[model samples]
Target chain A: MHSRTSFSVLIFILLIWEILVNLLHIPKFILPAPSLIIYTCFSQAPLLLENTLVTAVEILLGLMISLAISIPLAIVMFSFPSVDAAITPFLVISQAIPIFALAPLLVVWFGYGLLSKIIMATIVIFFPLTVSLHSGFKQVDPDYEVLFDLLDASFWKKMRFLYWPAALPSFFAGLKMAVAVATIGAVLGEWVGAQKGLGYLMIQMNARLRTDMLFAALVWLSAMGMGMWLLVGKLEKHFLFWLNDTKN
Target chain B: MLRVCDISKIYSDLAVFTNISFMVEKGSFAAFLGPSGCGKSTLFRVIAGIESSDSGHIEWEGLKLLNLKENTAMMLQKDLLLPWFDILDNVLIPIKTLKRDTKTGESEAKRLLSRFGLSGFEHYLPYQISGGMRQRAALVRTLLFDREIFLLDEPLSALDALTRQSLQKEILRIQLEFDKTVLMITHDIMEALMLADKIFLLSHLPMRIIKEIDLSNLPKPRYHLDFELAEMAENIFFTLKGELINA
Candidate 1:
């Protein structure tokens, strides 16, 4: 029933786009029809697929790096409050240096390759993950802390038994946000300076006034974002079934 | 045997208790009964060595217990079962924390869980079970370490009346079967009368034992003896009221 409703909505939206294009006599270069975009995707399938693969790798690598670094950093910060106090201001200031401005510097430092894109993606993804995980760690029940103390559990035991499990739901929440930003971060890095990637392809197509090709790249990017979102959602459901039932 | 000598606890400017002393036989059930915020729970924590007393000492079998291993297990009011852990794993937590060999502890854990009527629910998480089942799991966890003494901080208070009554019986049966010393803290006068061999009535805030009642002659199970136990309950209630008013 949901799929049927969504299909009908998609057709309705297409009809409206067609009507707007015809009534306003809008140039196709500015806004290509959905059908034209589809055709462009088929014709330039090979190049588009290649660039899409590159962007996907960049996003995935960035996400992996961010998870590796941020999760441990959160654990450290949680273990020692002073570490969190020291790192929080720097983490806050990092977000202020607009990605647009930092992208050029990243390319210059990392020399316009996968490293640069991955770095940008890491920067975009890590902050939310750190903050969310830290909050989750902080939110563990005080009763559990007392129980741990009574048992004389070591620091690692406390984290393994309580902190990790309590923080999982929030960690997944951060991952959802991280995945979306990771895709944008990769694209932004590619846009600044890159030989190959969806963002580069989009730039080239835009310069040549091939709006259909540009839109095709955009459609693929959106699909990638949605794909990552659905993947994480499935994982969260599989591992966190208890959380779902309890929440309801 | 455990002996507490002149133990006092003070928090900032407020004195929780002063010069409190008690002794528990090697295998017996003792209870501390009082109103809310009367320091019953605080005293329980101190006994468990989870909190420190401002002055005085605790000794077990001629060994000083200050900053020393007591081989004691505490069951809190809440189950404190990890949400991610199943019943069996929850029961095995103490074994794991104490770094006992898993092979030996696993079989022991299984035996105890089955004995406690939690055999089939071994793989079920805390949320999947009822409150009574969760408390049973908590008890099994507390027992897994083979601790000689058990500190129960109102372990069955969250259950419904019927479940609470059943658990009371279960706890008494386990205490008899294991021959372990039990120190329980509760506000329910009936509970203290039903299960405890001796009950200590405590005053509010800076709690001190004002009265001790011996219920060893009431009946095998005090809950079923309405006429006889009701009088004991009334006496305990009056004593508790007096303690509160005196404070």
Candidate 2:
């Protein structure tokens, strides 16, 4: 029932757009009708789909790389407090450099290719993952620490038996945020230097005063973000199913 | 057998307790009863080798126990069952971590779960069960370590009254059946009287064993010994209250 209501509301929004564009004589170059955007998407379906795939690949690779690096980094930081103390200031400084300022530098270093975009996404996505996971590791109950010590558990055993499980929920939360932001990071990186991505395609369409095509590219980007978000949600549900039973 | 000698703990120049000494004979049950903030839990941690005292020594069967391999299992006020683990997995945690090869211990855990009325809930996570059930699972986890000595720090204080009573009875049954030495800490004088063969009453702050009472003469089926136990509890309370007055 909620789905139906949302679908109707979306349709209603599109209908209003159509009426305003045709009856009010709004220029197509300024604000294209939803139908025109949909028609442009269909007509340029192959190019649009290819660019979408490139952007998706960049986001996925970047997110995977970030996860691989940051999770172990977090575990290391958690296991050794001095390491955390040493690296935390540098981590903060990394985030302090604006992505806009960093994007062109990344392109210069890595060139106008997937590498630069992937690097951008990694830089953008890693902070939250590391911070969230570190906080989760820090939040392990002292009582459980005592229990672990009493059991004569090894360091790895403590991490496996206690730290990992304690950090999972927070890690998933950070992953969700990373997924959403990763797409934007990929697009931003592409905007600065890439020759073949949805972001570049949108820029080309805008220069040609093809607003409908530009809007169509934007629709694809939004769809990709939502799709990745849903995938993360499904993974979270699959891994943390016990959370649901407890909530209810 | 476990023996603690002149164990004193201080933090940042403030003494938590000092010159505390006690011994637990193999297969005997000892309870520590004190008001809140008496550092009973800290003492338990010291005994379990989870913390170091400023000065003292602990021996388990003639082995110095400070920073040593803990042959003791400790249970806390709140059931610390890992939220992600099912009852069976939670119970098996210590064994899995310690890597002890003991099929007998595993079977003993299973038996204790069923005996304590957690028979069908083995696959359920800690949050899926009630407080009492979770505590029972924790007890089984502690037992699975095959420790000769069990240290319980207010293990049932979080339960509802009825559940607390039931679990207390269950613990007593397990103690008799397993014949393991048990050292428990509690603020409840009634619990001390009902379950303890010997009770140590502790003073506040720099806590020490102010009095020791023997309850071995008390009747079995603890509820039946209520009146006499209540009188003993009152005496404990009087001593504890007097300590507060002196402080």
Per-model DockQ against the true two-chain complex: 0.58, 0.75
**Candidate 1 TM-score, true structure as reference:** 0.94
Report the lDDT tens digits of candidate 1 across residue range A119-230: 9999999998899899999999988887777678998999998888889899999989988788889999999999899999999999999998999999889888989999
- Cα lDDT over the full model 2: 0.86
Model 2, first chain, TM-score of 0.94
> Model 1, residue A26: displacement in angstroms?
0.9
- CAPRI quality level assigned to candidate 2 from its DockQ score: medium
Highest DockQ among the candidates is held by which one? 2
lDDT of every predicted structure (CA atoms): 0.87, 0.86
Model 1 per-residue lDDT tens digits across residues B1-247: 7888899999999999998998887778998888898788778778777788899888888887662235678888899988888888888888888899999999999998898899999999789899999999898888885878888899988899999998898899878899888999887888887888888888787778788777666556655568777887898898878876876
Best-matching candidate per lDDT: 1
Real contacts retained, model 1? 0.59
